[model samples]
Target: REHEPLITVEVAVQLTDAKKFFKVPRTFRVMVCPGATVATFREVVGQDLAPSGRVMVPRGKEAMMALQDSEELPDKVTVTEFKGKRQVYVKFTMAQCYKVLSLLRGHLEKAESQKALHEAAIEVAEDEMEYRLRLSQFLMTEAYPVVCRHFGLGCDGVESLRVIPAGMYLVDQHLELLELQLEVETLMKNRGTVNFLMGKINELRHKFGLPPADYPPHLLNFVYSQSLLS
Candidate 1:
């Protein structure tokens, strides 16, 4: 209720999603209460403004009031472009109309979801394969040396990375990285933690024992040469 909302403003609405492509209303009106503030107008219908393809379910004070008892009235409706073309019964209240609007928030837009989902799916696959290879190599070449140096449990014939408890050891190594990436992605999605993103980079560098990213070029080159030659 906005504008001339005395007791309550009667309204009609349609909101739903199970249709082809994005939906939009065939036609709609711009009527608003004469003295309704911009805030009031927003309160009433600001959210229904999605373009073609997104659900444009009908919404209006008159429509909601008019179709209060129509048998053909939809419990929910999807919109198509050109609200004039989309046939929807009037909604009953801004609240009822907006309830269906809630469904729109998580609706995956095709391009974004596909790209993100594909990236995630492929990333997990590639990371898993790489982790398996590196971990297998680590057990044979590195862990035994480390274990021998530290615990002395590494004895004869312990040639490879000890296969500890099947997949458990491998999971421990890569899962931490995966968890960090997931946390970063979640924060980014909600437009949060620019500071944390920077902090994370610093933390990861230290955690991985990495040299400063901006280390002098000659020093880096010498280090690289030493690594290769030595």
Candidate 2:
């Protein structure tokens, strides 16, 4: 109202009690009544030039409300903005301040819940990626040699392999050995091997506070023996 004394109110980033909220050089500034309650103050902060008044915000009607809700807002504080161009002021009765604080408390709890959920989701994704890498490494170091021995293929220093020997130089013997090697490679790459390794890796990963690894589909098609040859 025109009869009301307009006390300049400037909302600051430092006003947040904990966990610094706003990062940039920005704030909410408006002239509000010294007699206004927190509820009225909220309305003033959200009001734009709907009536085409001097209170023109940078964005629109909802700008201050959006900024206020995003962080822990200060209460009944007096400060200065732009040294003197904007004067920071707030005057709330104890009862009104308490009510606003209660509402903000509930909002903080909800914000914290949202933050925790987001962080948990990211942690799950990163842990799964690490699990896959570790599982692949285990297969190469532990399972590959076992597969090679079963197929009678000689692994050279855990590196390359000697081709299946054609004993007696018989073509049939050479083809049979080749077929056996291919079968061994297929089994090593089967989904069963992935499932087996997941079980082993989960035990170690979980011990280190990481989430358990799920049986991955991509791992089922990753041919370790063929990759080694390549």
lDDT of 1 at 40: 38
lDDT of 1 by residue, 46-140 (tens): 33533332332356754422222122323233332222321111211333222212222222233554354345434545353443444344335
TM-scores for all predictions: 0.16, 0.18
After aligning candidate 1 to the native by TM-score, how far in Å is the CA of 126 from where it should be? 2.8
Candidate 2 colliding pairs, count: 0
> With candidate 1 superimposed using the best TM-score fit, by how many Å does residue 199's alpha carbon deviate from the native?
26
| TM-score, candidate number 2 | 0.18
How well does candidate 1 score on lDDT at residue 80? 28
Runs in model 2 lying further than 4 Å from the true structure: 13-22, 47-230
The C-alpha stretches of model 1 lying farther than 4 A from their native spots are 1-127, 154-160, 163-230
Q: Per-residue lDDT for 142-220 in model 2, tens only? A: 4445433432334423241212111112222233322333333233333344444445455656565777654344444
For model 2, which pairs clash?
Answer: none
Q: After superposition, how far is residue 136 of candidate 2 from its true place, in Å?
A: 67
On TM-score, the leading prediction is: 2
